[model samples]
Structure formats: structure tokens, C-alpha cells
Target: MGHVFGAFTVLVCALFGVVITANGITVDVNDEVSIKSAARIVADGLMNYYHGNESGRIPGVFDGGYYWWESGAAWGSMLDYWFFTGDDTYVEVAKEGMLFQVGTDWDYMPKNQTLSLGNDDQGFWGITAMMAAERNFTNPSSDEPQWLALAQAVFNSIALVWDSQYCSGGVRWQKFVFNNGYDYKNSISNGVLFQLGARLQRYTKNETYGYWAEKVWDWESTIGLIDNTTSYVYDGGSIETNCQVLNKIQWTYNMAVYMAGAAYMYNYTESDTWKTRLDNLINTLDVFLYGNTNVLYEPACEPSASCNVDQQSFKAYISRWMGATIQLAPYTYNTLFPMLTTSALAAIRTCNGGLDGVTCGYTWLTGTYDGKYGLGEQMAALEVLQSQLIPYTVAPYTNDTGGTSIGNPNAGTGVLGSQTSSATSQTKDKAGAWIITCVLSAIAILTSIWMAMDGKGEAKKLQEWIRVESNYA
Candidate 1:
């Protein structure tokens, strides 16, 4: 009887264990599919931007023409696509788009240049161009020198305008003070310079680039242009506060550029401080920017403001930054995956909201509903999905046994089970033991019943003995 009971207990435990393992595996498969779907959405967007013939000249409702900042963001999308796909086709498209910005002359003179060279605009455009140029330079083709020269010319031209006073702390939007010098010391301006400096350092292997990047980073932090308080950084300084104000609120791009630059700087210098900074930034973004909500509101922004309260802008930025961060720090796969996955899913929701070619609420000044599907928004969504999906696409996870089992228990797998597998396994084991114990108790109760049927005195003795043994055990 004892042998039979022991065998039954072991069998039940093992079966229950297998059931728990199977449930976990089912959950993992679901999560992986969700992640893959999210990645696909992002990839589709990227493909659309590269191949879609959407005209770039649509007038924004608030702003009169296509924003140069938006154009720069488009470049970011292309870069993301290239990084994730490792497909030269996306890279080629990115180069062409950047060169188009440089125009036919490729000179810094701004001849026939219709695009705004406002300090902030120039910084954004130049930095993106520099990045494209650096990327092109690494694998020089016929167009490499042209791209480099064009990028350098624009960068130097912007640098030439710096007087170390008005544009002193960093780059201002323009020479004129707009909205109480709010235009001065813009976060985007500093962010771009930070990007440029980091890229330049990598391409040139010169410490000067690092120096400039660090200087801009310091300025951004000290001036509070980037939100110092939030785990995620804000868009730019408030026009009124000279202190960082979250007016247009928290844009994903703002944090993305900061993280991308920080990650790059860490890579270049192998600095733990930068790595920590990058990790914290990513962590904050993942927590705040995700969930079922389609809109991301800047907690600091006045709820009343029309221009600053746009949720699509927030979505746009989130996708942008996630893609960039992934590109910059591929090794931080665990950190980057959730961000990309969540942002991609959110972006899909944004698209479903009929945001296509609709002016985002953030473009308050541009009231006209310019065809809403701009390159920046589209590209951001695409880059995230494409980059994440590429790995799975190139090499499908063939070890996919339908049988439930623990996957590799590692913190960096970026899968949920990877983080909690051990704890979950121990919990299941404990739960199985309790179940087995309960079954044994049931058996004891039945045994006592049988004894009672045979004789009352004997039943009482058997019950007491069973209780004593069970309690001791």
C-alpha cells in the first residue's frame, strides 16, 4: 500500500509539473507572437516610407510647410531601417533622402535652399545628415564623398553661426528672440549637436568630437533643457522659464536622441556611467510610454494648451527613440526589445486612429490638416517593427518544440519568463508538493473510514495514529 501510494504521489507530481511547464510554454509562444506582430507593424511603416511616394511638401496645419525637424526625423527612420535590416536597400534610400536635403549644389551657401535654417532646424538636419554621412563613409561608394562633404558643409555652416553668447550656451533657433528667448537653448538643438559630436567622434576617432558632445550634454543637463527630474527626458526648454519646461511635453525623440548619444558615448569610451544613464533612460521610457493607451500626455504640460498636448507626437517620438536606441545598443537587447515591442503596438493603434495624413495636435501653429502621413511619423513606426522582426525573419526559432520546457534562464533574453523562470519553477514545485500532501491526507481519511466500518475502538486508534504520524511528518 505504501509503495503504491508513493508511486501515485510521484506520478501526480510529475504530471502536474508537466502541465505547469506546458502552460508556461503556451504563454511564451503567445508573447513571442505578439512581439513579432509588433515588429512587423514597425517594419511595414519603414518599408512604406522608403517605397511610398508620399509627397514631403504637404503643409502642416500649424506650420506653413513641412518642418525641417520632421525631415530630420525621416532620416532617423531610414537609419533605423538600415541598422535593423542590414539591408543596403534601406541604406540607399536613406542616403538619397539626405542628399535630397543637401540639394544639387551640396554647398553650405544655402543656394536654392527652401528649407529653414533656423538654429534648431539646422541642428536637427545637420546632425541627421552627419549620421548618414558617417554611415556612408564606412562603406564608401561613389556617393560617399558627396554625402560626407555635404554633411560637413552643413555642420560647419551651422558652427560658423555660433557666437558663443546668444547661441552661446548652445544653438538657438535663430538670432532673433522668439517668445522671450525660448528659441534659445532648445533641447532639440542641443540634442542634435550631442548626436553629431558622438558620431563625429566615432568616424574621426577624434576626442574633439567627444569634447563637444560632452559639452552639449553638460549644457543640456545644467540648463534643464532636458527634463532632469523625469527618468525620461522632455522635449525642450520652456520659452518662458529658461528652465526646462515640458510644454510640447515629453516627446519620445527627445529621450531617444539623448539615449542614443549616451549609448554611443559609452560605447566609444567604454564608460559605465553612460551605460547606467542609458539603462535608466530606457527603463523610464518603457514604463511611462507603453500600455493600451494610444496617447502619451506630458504630465508637466498644461492640460489647456492645444499645441503641446498632442498624443500622436508622443507616439511618433517613442517609436523614433526606440528604433534609435536599439540601433545604438544592440547588446542591450533585453532593454530594447520591450520598448520596441510596446511602441510598435502603440503605433499600430495610432494608425488605426486615422492619424494618416492628419495634422497632429502638437502642430498648433499649423492649423491646416496637411496630409497627415509625414515621413517622420511613418518612418518611426516602421523602423521599430522592421528592426525587431529582422532577426526572427532571417532565422526562425526552429527549436520550437510544442512540448513545454524552460527556455534559457538569463536576464538578458528580453522574454518575460527569462526574468522569472527560476522563481516560477520553484513555486510550481512547492505547489505540487502541497497537492500531493492533500491527496495523502484524503487517503488517510479514507483509511480511517474503513477502520471505523470494521470496529469503533480500532477506528479511533487508527485515526489517532494517522494524525500523530502526519503531524510529525
Candidate 2:
């Protein structure tokens, strides 16, 4: 494949007082040079856990307890890194990892990941693909899947599975019925779809994508996942209860995705409603920001020391999407800069762990290393620090602009299954269908029980494995 390289100046500045070496990273949000220097060190810390480029390792996989899904997110952060800092150091590996994981169908639903794959999981890769297209990242070869097409394929595939039968309308957490969280209708899944649709609409100038974006926003509002008046987004609800029993635990990424989506809508339509929604969503983020400090934190799990591996990384998306929001909604800079810079400063303080003394910890409010480090910690710190370049960079590209990625509107058409018709059902067939449903329900029940007993524990096992792998590496 042909590659494009951007000239990057990775400078190590020892400017007196302008840059302070906090632990192992430079601390100076005021100087772009200092910010990029800090970001480079943090990015290096992040890559320390990545073994994807090794001969025996999977091209896109990370070395730690990171899952197939978060690997995509990690690469997305690298894309952001390259975009923000003009550092092409990781783009070749990023492209390889991203391309290697877009399964034969080109939708990111690689068969190897089918067991644990959730709608949100596939959505993360699609989000990354969309970012590549928007950022005008180095394109793939003629035979490879184009970034826009990959994202569109994911959108179409997930759109086919949008379950109107449950809770009136919402996507399930897991794509397959056999998966553990299939009965849950989560905001992250729907929010991702909304964000993807909004971004595609802006890039393609397509109303169909915009329509889906609107539909998701409306459904989330009607189902009480999003309180439109306050713009407060809750986690999700169980479909078995018809989505009534809500999990009110709010995470930063949930709000970030939807806010970025709304900002895209506002930018595309230049309408008052979307602008108000975007502003309200931004205002509602006070829930994640620490009291008057403007520093970000995970309220649901950070304070209690209970955040799992996945939850530990949620704040990165907040910084990631907020930076994107500034491009689409330029007026938000003054309101958002303080929040981002404040959080970045606090987050860098946690980068005093690991042998290199720059590996970041999870909790930023601690003002010192909390001894935690992984893909989550490093990626979180990289994003918060590199996002300082938001004001210094150009806005993302669209087809009308300089975006070079080729897209297929009907990308996932081949994967869309035909809807079963009730009119053609026979009495015997109906009986058989009922029996099948009953058996599947029993299996689902058993799966739920097993998950309750052991599913989440798999994360711990994976984490331990990753620790061992990193140690050996």
C-alpha cells in the first residue's frame, strides 16, 4: 500500500518555567510546544503496552487486558494523536491495526470477535473508521476497505438489528441473542449510532443518515435515557422490563458521544434546536467535572474505587469528542478550553507510575500516582494532553472539502437479512417458532445466570493475562 507521511517536529523543550517536568511529563498548557511534548511522552507511554506490531501478535491487538473493542478505540486515539500533533510516528501501525480488524464483510464485525461482540463494540471500530475519513488520514490500497465504507457498513449492519419490538425502538447492547447483555438497551450503543449517523450526514450531505441520527435522539429521549430538558443521559435499561428499570449510572462517554453528535447536527443544519441541545448537553456535563475545578472524573466509579477496566477509560472519549465538538461548534472553545486544560493538567500528574516513570494512573484527582496503569490510563492521558492542540488545528474534512476517502452508500446491503413475514406463517411453523423462541429464552436465561456468576470475571482473567504479557514483553 502507498503511504503518506506528514512532517512532524517532536521537540524536547527545556524552556525555563515555561515547561515543568511533572513526574515524567512536561506541564505547561499555555505553550503549545510544552503541550505537544507532554503529549508525546504520554503517547509513548501508551504505546509501551501495544504489541500489535510484533510478529506473533495480532496486527491491531493491544498487549494488556484490553479487549478487541478497546483496541479499536486505542487506535482511534492514535489517529487523534497524529491529527493533533502532526506525528506520523504511529500512523502506519494505526492503519494496519484498523485495516486488519475490518472483517471480511468490511464492517468491523470480525468473526473472531463474535463471541463477546456488542453493538457498542462494533460501533467503536466504526467510530474509528469515521474519524479516519474525517481526518483525511492516509488512505488504503485499491483492494483494501475504504474508511468511509467500513463505517457505513457498520452503520447499516447495526441499523438492520435496531429492535423496534423491544421498548418501542432501541438497539440491544449485544448484537447476538446468545450474548450476555442482549436484553439491555444501552445509551452508549444508541449514542454511537447517533454520533456515526450525524457525522456521516455532515460528510456525505445525506438526509438519510441525518434522519437516523434524529430518530435515535428522539427514541433515547422518549425512552428516558436522555432527559431532553436537562440533557442528562442515563446509562441504559433492561429490555425484559420494557426498558422501565433504568440504570441511572451516568458515565462521561455516554454524554460525550451524544454531545458531539448534537454538535455535528447543529453544525450541519445551523438550526436552533440542535444548537440548544448541544449547549444543554455541554452544560449537563457538570456531573462529570469535579466541583468548581473543571477537572473531569468518573462520578459513578472513580470516587468509590470500583471502576472496571472499561469504565476507567471513559474519560478519554470526553476529551476526544469535546475536541471534535470545537471543530463543529467553534463557539464552544471559550466554554470548553478551561474544562479541557484543567482536566489535562490534573491527568498528567497521575503519570508517575511504571518503570519509565511516565505511565499514567487512573484517578486524576489524587494529585499523585495511584499506582494504576494500562491502555486506559495511558490513552486517557494522551487524549487529554493532545487535545490541547484543538485550537491550533484545522477542522475535520467532508466530501465537499478535502476528504479523500471513498464511501459506499449501500455498503452493508449484502449483509442485511430479509424481515420475516407474519402473513406467510403456517400454524405448524408458528408452533415450531414458538418452541424455538422458548428454547432460546431458556438459553438466554442460562447465559444470564452464567454471566452473573462468571462473565464479568473474565475481564479480570484477561487483565491478569495482559499483565503477564506486558511483563514478559
Candidate 3:
């Protein structure tokens, strides 16, 4: 009987341990899947941007023919994928894309000159360059001097346009404006600066880069442009001072870039303060941009009662923002997945499986829906979905299979159809749930084992003491 009890106890303890381990593994797998989906989105987006010729330099005709500026963002996504997956293909894709961006050999650029480097453009390119420098510098193919030089040149141009006055440190819209000493402090411009500073710090190990990043944060924070009161970030600030900026004007693309840049900065600096700031920004933005209430509001044309302009609705803003969020998933915290999932689902519903059906006022009607429908919307959705799926230990149901529909007819009506049944959708939900369950179970089992082990040790000690007493008697 004692032996049986002991064996039972041992089994229970072992089972508990297994549960704990399984739970942890599940959580990690979920995170891995999210990271993978992010990487694939980046790669596919970049490929589309470069090779997609349906309507000129426009990548895909989905999101209302909108220029998502995803190429630079994709680089960051691919870098994250390479880091987590340890896949050479992802690394190669990243290297090739970055090279293509700066390569003078492309048909887009003049043979004598490289791509036209703009501050916003270069800021993003700089991120890709820094990631490349960190990961692929050892490989001869990735050690392209021209790409590095172009990236640096872009940074130099951006730095030259930094205006010290006007609101701490902020970037100009263009180098020409900086050369002329015209510093206009737009939120987008500052967002670019914030990301660039963080990326530079990572690549060069320069404190100044981080310092500049913080400066941008400080400037935005003081103005209440970024969510100082909450944990998430908002969209651009008002064009006119005293014009009421909607707290819920959380555009997806800007928030993604901002969060990604902030997260990257936090990772490199290990700054708890930064992390706190990032958390606050993310929470606030998620509530505003993605919450069920649809808190999104467009910019008012003027503060007067007569100047009420609805501005762009939530759907329009999401078309742009979703792309950015997908690209930055790698650098941000794991909690981003839930928010991303919500957003993707919402987008799919709104567009109803047809890109044209989505009147996001941006990228639509320019490309084929392929089999999934809603080409541009699907592109962004796939990017997010792909990013989430790539790093799992278990295979995620990717919509890579041919017959899946992209949008939903009853989506905005609050009813999702079969597209919800697609492998991508099911796999994402499964992966997330599986990880959560596994991790929680594992933790519970581990705790049980520890308790059982303690009890067994106590029992053994008591037995030894009783035996000694009996022998002495």
C-alpha cells in the first residue's frame, strides 16, 4: 500500500511537471507563430512592392491602391523572423529586399542614381539596414557596402533636417526643407525620428541615437500627442493648435511603427521606463483604435460647430495602419497578437471578402482579389496572419490553400462567414488558445509536483526517525 501511494504520488508529480512544461511550450509556440506570420507578411509585401507591376510602383491593387510604404517596414518584420526562426531563407529575403531598395540597377531608379532618398523613406530604410548590419554582416552577400552607404546617407539627410527648437527634436518632411531651415513638426515626421533614433542606437551602439529617440518621445509626450494619460498611442496631432484631437484617432500603420520603434528601443536599452511608456501607449491606442466601441474619429476641418468634418472613418485608417502593425510585430511584446487578431478580423468583416467593397479611401480597385477577394485588404490581412503563423511548433492553418475567400459580406453587419473557417483564421485562434492552455496547465502541474516532492521528503524523514527509535528501543 505504501509503495502504491509512493508510485501514485510520483506519477502525479510527473504529470504536474509535464503540464507546466507543456503550458510554457504552448505559449512560446504561439509567440513563434505570431512572429512567423509577421515575417512572411514582410517578405510578401516587399516582393509585391518590388515585383508587383499591376499598376506601376504600387505593390498590389488591394487597399484602394494606397501606397502603404510597407517595403521599409517589411525589412523590420523579416529581421524579426530571421531572429526567431533561424531560417536562412528569411534572412536572404530580407537582404535581397533591402538591397533592391537601395540598388541603382532597378528600372525605377536612374542608372546613375540610386532610389530617391526621403526622410520618412530613409528612416524606414535605416531600420532595415541596422537589422541587416547586426544579423548578416558576416555573410558576404549581406555585406553590401552600397546598401550600407545608402542607408547612412539617408540618415545623414534626416539628421540634417532635425529642428532643435519648434518642439525639442523633430525631423523635417524632407532634406530640402531641412537645408532651407524650415522645420515643420508633424507627428509623422517625429514618428520617423523616434524609430530612426532607436534603430541607429541598435546598429551603432551609440547612446546619442537612443537619446534622440527619447527626445522625440519627450516632445510628443509633452504635447499630449502620444497617449500620456493612457498606455497606447494615437494618430497624428491636430493641424491647428487648440483643435481638438480625437483620442481614438489611432491609425494602425503609425501606431505599429511607433510601437515597434519604441519596443526596439526598449529591447536595446533595457529601459523599464521606456517599456512602461510603451505599454501605456499601446494600451491607450488599442482601446482607441481597436476596441469594440469603434472610438475612431476623423480630424475636424475646424474647431467651430460649422466646421464639422467626419474626416476618415475607422475603416479608412485601418487600411493604412494594419500594414504597419504587421511589420512591427517582431519587435513589440507578445500581447500585440490579441490586438492584431481583433483588427484583422474586423478588417476582413468590413471588406466582405472584396477589396473593392472596402471604401477605406486608400488602396482599393487596383489589383486582382485572386481567390481570397479584396486584394489590398487581403494583402495586409495576410501579412498580419502570416506573421502570426510562422514561429509555432505546431503548423498553423495558413490560408495559403487556393480556395479561401478574403473578405465577408456580413462582416460590418457583425456577422462573419466561411472566411472565418479558412485555415489562417482557425490556426491563429488555435495557436493562441493552445499556448495559453498549455502554459497555464504546465504551471499548475509544476506547482503540484513541488508540493508532492516536499510531502514525500517529509514522509521519508519521519520513517527514518521511527526506524532509529525502534532500533534504539
Per-residue lDDT over 111-195 for candidate 3, one digit per residue giving the tens place of the 0 to 100 score:
2222233455446555555444443432323233333334334444454445443344455443342122122244655677687
| Residue 392 lDDT (model 1) | 47
Displacement of residue 375 (Cα, Å) in model 1 is 4.0
The TM-scores, one per candidate, come to: 0.56, 0.84, 0.50
- In model 2, how large is the Cα lDDT of residue 218? 95
Candidate 1 per-residue lDDT, tens place, 299-414, comes to 33313232221233444555555555555566777766654543333333334323333211121111122224444445544554454453443211111211111211111111
After superposition, candidate 3 runs with Cα above 4 Å error: 1-70, 74-97, 103-118, 134-143, 146-152, 178-183, 230-249, 293-334, 344-379, 390-473
Against the true structure, candidate 3 reaches a TM-score of: 0.50
- In model 3, where is the ten-residue run with the lowest total lDDT? 19-28
Measured by lDDT, the strongest candidate is 2
CA RMSD, predictions in order: 28.8, 11.0, 26.3
As for TM-score, the candidate ahead, 1 or 2, is: 2
Q: After superposition, how far is residue 162 of candidate 3 from its true place, in Å?
A: 0.8
lDDT of each: 0.45, 0.79, 0.40
Lowest lDDT 10-residue stretch of candidate 2: 1-10
Task: Indicate the TM-score of model 2.
Answer: 0.84
